[model samples]
Target: MKQLIIAEKPSVARDIASVLGATQKSKNYIEGKNVIVTWALGHLLGLKMPEDYNKDWTTWEMNTLPMIPKKTGIKPLPKTRPQLKAISQLANRADVSEAVIATDAGREGELVARWILQYVKFKKPVKRLWISSQTDKAIKDGFKNLKPSKMYDDLYYSAIARAESDWLVGLNVTRALTVKYKDSLSAGRVQTPTLAMVRRQEEKQETFKPENYFTLDLTYQGLSGKLQLKNPRQYKERQELEKLIKQVEGTPIKVVDINEKTKKEGAPLPYDLTEMQREANARYQYSAKKTLSIIQRLYETHKIVTYPRTDSKYLTTDLKQTMKDRLQAVTVMDSDRVKGIIRNGGTVLQKSVFQDKKVTDHHGLIPTEQAPRLEKLDNEELKIYRLIVERFLGLFEEPFVSTNQTIKAEVKGYIFLFRQSKVETYGWKQEKETTQKRVDFKIGQVIPANFVINKELTTPPASLNEGTLLGQMEKHNLGTPATRAEIIEKLISSELMERSNSKLSVTPKGKQLLTLVNPSLVTPELTQKWEISLEKIAQGQLNYQAFIKEIEQETTALVKEIKMSEDNYVDHSLTTKVCPDCGEKLREKNTRDGKIYVCSSEGCSYRRRKDPKLSNRRCSQCKKKMEILENKNGAYFKCKNCNITEKLDPKGKKNKKMTKHETNRLMKKVNQEEEQESPLALALKAAMEKK
Candidate 1:
């Protein structure tokens, strides 16, 4: 009997089959002497929609909401059903006595294979292939040491709980809001709280006020060194600062104290997906989503980088042998400087990069078993490869050493202090110039401290931009590394946050939404509560079912309160123009080229593009009026009211064109702006109303 092997994608399946002696290849699978390998296109099946149960409930309505089915349903996507069916057939074949699950070694990947097996009722004894790297040696070794499938049953259970809970909460709340607000809106456990974060930031920024403060700076020619105030700001009142400056004018400074300490700076932690994404965003101005996609392609397609979505930034002790191999891979790419660092073969392994406590889901992103052949790749691939190389090299280098000095003095009874630093050793910082730009200070170098006695100075009020505010939020546990990028992206995409010259500003629409919404619903504290509970559930310290029941009870009371309240939701996108066909109101939308007029009433689906050419050209009958209509065949613009169709070339400069993908992406923003209900917001709002 042959052993059946299943993989997450065709690329992985082919590689596995090659190592397993599977030479025969097909469109979606491969074959070996004793094993037949197949692939699932990411997810072969997903939870079914409410419409699947009954077509009558296709349109969302409040009465039919809270549609919680006792047993969840699943269906294969129509376009990919044939491929899934083939996989099912192979798994249940008469000659196949056993099967091996070779999907990704993550919780989600486990669920993907288990669900397919459950749906197909494949009763064959199963084993799991849990290798992170897809190199020939790793694949062969993994097959030689296959583990029983039951070992990962707990992981599968945890994943199922998460998926089912998301479905229950997301679908019900999404339907409820859409029905109540008369707009197609969605809410998710991840997406809603994410949106709330953006809204709150906008609110805080809009209401921010700047305060004024004054300081007295003392600059004097000193025999030892120049002197300046340590903590400059003395008072908020101008009269108070003037009194201090007057006392210190023309005062001879005296040295009070001097202190020095030697310090060593440890090497930075290896690259995790989040930290790498943040750096790439800051350095290259690339969005988080774009970085993830690029790294995913590098890992799954090119097999150069290790897993790209990891949270941990440390390698396990077992992976130490591969470190040297990884370094050698970089050397093959012609980086002599990095190669020279490893040529000495000195013992540089430190406990900092080999800790098991720091790792959670997986280890940090590193080079895979494959060599870094960046020249063979594209621009995006090369950029991602360079990041991995730089980080990997940084991990093996020595820690930086420096001397920190603090000097103190008193002039006219006014105590002043200053700080300076000098690098004792370059260490790992020598690889990057940006990392090496440390300010150097000698033990007794007398220099200007940027302050003079009797000089007027003012302290600017503290303010935070999007980036700094994000940093603050992260410190408070308001968002995770994975979610931060998405939150920022959503804020910008929703037009709740705008960037002008790299600074974030809140829009009028955003301010209005924040004022109208319930405060507790849009605060970071709500997510903090959820995150605490989520961590408990992950650790098996909290019951998953009990958590869901609590949420349901809270949601039940909240909805009733929202209905009783007198708060009115204003429709921001209301338009005065009537639809030509149905006489319903026409809503304005932002198209790729410009604004477009679309029908507001459901099922009408009428749309008309704004004609710039017709608006520009003057008509003969009425010199002020412009042509408004054009024939179907690329001809001339004609007046809609006058019915005058004139033939002309279509190559005028006034014509605007855009691809369908670009047009749809721009239109989606307008659609989202028209929506008022947020799933997470609605839930919290409903609960707060009851309170």
Candidate 2:
């Protein structure tokens, strides 16, 4: 009898199958003498929706809220039902005896396999394949040392609790707000607190009052020092500051004291997913989601990096033996730097990096032993790969050493301080030395002073960009490293917040959402508590059922609060134009594509593109761009500049325009095609059909 192995994705399944000699490939699985490999498309089964429990709960009504089922059931996700069936059939095969869970080695990964196993009612013994990297050696090592699946049952339980709790709170509260406010407002355990942080920063920006301040700088024989003050850095009255500057101007300054100290800074910790996202955003202005995607590609497609969704920044002790191979794999990218480390007796295995106790489900993001093909990588992949590789190499280098010097001078009794740093050793920084002018001073030596006063204004707190927001989320324990990016994206997609100039700002809808959402839901404390509870569940310290019970009680209270609250939500985007289908006023909403007019009625699902589609055709009279528009008559080109209109040819020329009916029919056909092709679209369509 062959052992069945299940992977999280088709690409991963192929990798495992290749390593296990399962080359006989079929449409759904790969077969070999001793193993049969199948795969799950992320999650093939999820918690049953509200309607699945009770049909009346499907409608969004104030009274029907807090739809907490006594026993939550699992259902096959409609789009992936075929794959689920394939796995089930393979599980029941006479030749397959025991199963191996080769899905991702994390809490969520455990859930993916456990849900499938439970749904298939696979009573055979189960084992788990846990490894950090996708390298062939790692895969072989993992299978050789497979552990009993029961060891990770607590992790599976925690995953279930997290998913069910989120559904309960998010769906119930979202339905409550949407029903009362008549707008598509969504709130979640992690996302609401995240939005609250952004809203708080915006509030600080709105209420900020800038104040002017002045500083007195004294220059003497190429030596410069700034006047230091005790309490207030601001000089509100310019007259008083001017008197002080005048008194200290052109006076002889005496060097009071000088202090010199040598300092050493060790290399920074390796990249956790959050830190990686933060650094990518700071350097390339890539969104957190964008950075995660790039690194995930580096991990899955390139097979160069380890897991990208790790929270730890330290490697396990076992990885010390593989450091040389990992470094050698990345030598192609920076041969000089990597080879130098190798030639100089290899890496030092710093205690900061190789701490097994600090590692969780997986070690830090590091390069695998697999050498990368530089030409195969795109620009973004190359960047992320270089980032991880450079960080790995830094672990071997010595600490950065420097000498800091501080000098204090007395100019007419007004004290001034100057500081400078000189690098004693570049170490891991690898900085080039440059000549800089130096000032030598002795105690009690007097020099002529040149004084200048500079005026500055106090600045408000900077807005939160993806980097800063990720930092905030990490600090608050708002979400795991894997889920934080999705939370930020959800805020943007829900129209509660917007990204501009690389900073996140609250929209009018976001501001209103904060006011309308329950106060408890809008604070980080709620998520922090939930995360702590979830962590305990994963560790087998707390019962997930009890925690879920508490969530149900909380959800009931939150919905009741919304029902009684007098606060109102006004749709600022509402317009006078009525929806063509529902006869309700259309709301002009800004989207990434452009502005769109959506029906204001909650039950109506009618929307149209409000922005005119620009066409290559130019106006004959004005020789400017023309807008392609259609009406009941047919397709035509119009120039807003000169009020010129021209009939488009109906013969479907190379530059032919489609009539309104044809355009809509074509869009419908395209959407239908996409629905057929995309799993997510199919799932959404299935849900809509059920409704």
Candidate 3:
């Protein structure tokens, strides 16, 4: 009898099938003598929407403030029904004995498989294949030591609880606010608090008042020192600073104290998903979502890196045995550095890098045994891969040893401090060169000195960039590593926040959202507690049902607050342009594509691009660029000057005239492509096609 193995994605299924000797491939699955491998496209099913439970909930109304269903159910996602149906057929096959869950090893991944199993009513015994990397050896070893499905029941329960609770709180609050405020506003357990944090920072920026101050800089024999004060670091009055500088201008400086110490700094921990995201945002100005997408490709498509959604930065103790192989896998990127480390017996495990207790769900992001072809990775992928490789190598390098020296000097009864660091060993910081100049000083020695007074003004807090916002999210425990990027992107898509000059700021809509949202929901405290409870549920320390019951109670209170609140919401984005369909004012909205005008009327679903996207296709008559516009018929290019229109074919080529049937088919294909293809996904697909 053959065992049915279900994977998370088709690409992943192919990898697993290859390792399991399931070479006989079909459209939906691969089969061998003893195994059949099927796959899910991310998630085959999701929690049912409110309208599925009650028809009355279809329309938004204040009366249905809190639409809580008696039981939350799962439904097959429309786009992926074919894959789900195929998996169901394979599960019930006569030759198939038991099923294996080969999805990604995480809470959501477990939910994906469990929902399908529940839907199919598969009564056969089930096992799970849990492995971090997609390398052949890891897959083979995972199957050989498959664990019973019951082992992860708590994790699955936790996933269900999280999904249900989010639906209850997010949907009810979002509906209540939208109906009462007459705007498309949204709030969530994680997203609302995150937006509130940005709004709060913006408030600080708006209310800040700068104060002028002065400081004295002391220079003595090629050494620099700043005047240290007792209370405020800067002198508030210019006259006070001038007097101090005059007193110490020609005074001989006496070194009162000298302290020297040797310090050893260990290498930084390896890349967890959050840390990697933070670094990528700071260095490359990549959005959290962008970095996650790139790293995910490195994990899922290239199979060069391990899991990308991990929270742990430490490897399990058992992974120590495979360290050499992982190091060797990345040698192609920097053969000299990796080979040198391996030759010097530097692959020995360290407690800082290998601790079984610290690893949860998956180990830190590291290269797999699959050696990467540098050419296969695009520019952004190469940047991320290089980060992971450098971090991994740092684990085996020696500690950075330095001699730190601090000197305290007194001139005219005022204390000044000078500090210097001399590097004794570069260690893991091999990429950087130390430029510190060594200087010797003895206590009670007088030195020639000069002083200069400099004026400065205090500045308001800087706006939160993607990197800093991610740091705040990590600090508040707002969301998991896997979901934080999605939350940020959601806030942007919902028009609550925006990105400008590489900094995150609360939009006018977002500022109003904070004032209108429930007071408890605006702070991180509520969500932090929820995240802690969810973690407890995953660890079996808390009952999932009880935790969800608390969330339901909170949802009821939040909805009631919104219903009773007397606050008013103003449509700041409303424009003078009126919607042609409903005679309502059009609201200007900023989108990634560009600004667009959306109808302000809640009941109207009218919107159009404020500025039409220019296409390369030129007007045959005018020889000028044409504007691309879409209608019920599909996308077509029209020339503003020549008043000529042409239909766009499926391949984006222009045709003078096309049949109605062809236009409809092209529109359907275009809709599907827009719905399913992200820029990174399309790029990866194109790259794979090239291969």
lDDT of each: 0.64, 0.84, 0.84
lDDT of 1 by residue, 600-683 (tens): 787687887755444555556655555645457654656666655555645565765878867866854443232122222333
Greater TM-score among 2 and 3 belongs to 3
My TM-score estimates for the predictions, one after another, are 0.79, 0.90, 0.91
Give RMSD to native, each candidate.
Answer: 7.7, 5.2, 5.9
Give the number of colliding residue pairs in candidate 3: 0
lDDT of the structure predicted as candidate 3: 0.84
Instruction: Give me the displacement of residue 632 in model 3, in angstroms.
Output: 13
Q: Which stretches of candidate 1 lie over 4 Å from their true place?
A: 53-57, 216-233, 236-243, 332-334, 431-521, 525-543, 590-596, 610-630, 633-691
Candidate 2 TM-score over all chains jointly:
0.90
Candidates arranged by TM-score, highest first: 3, 2, 1
Residue 518's C-alpha lDDT in candidate 2? 95
**Top candidate, metric TM-score:** 3
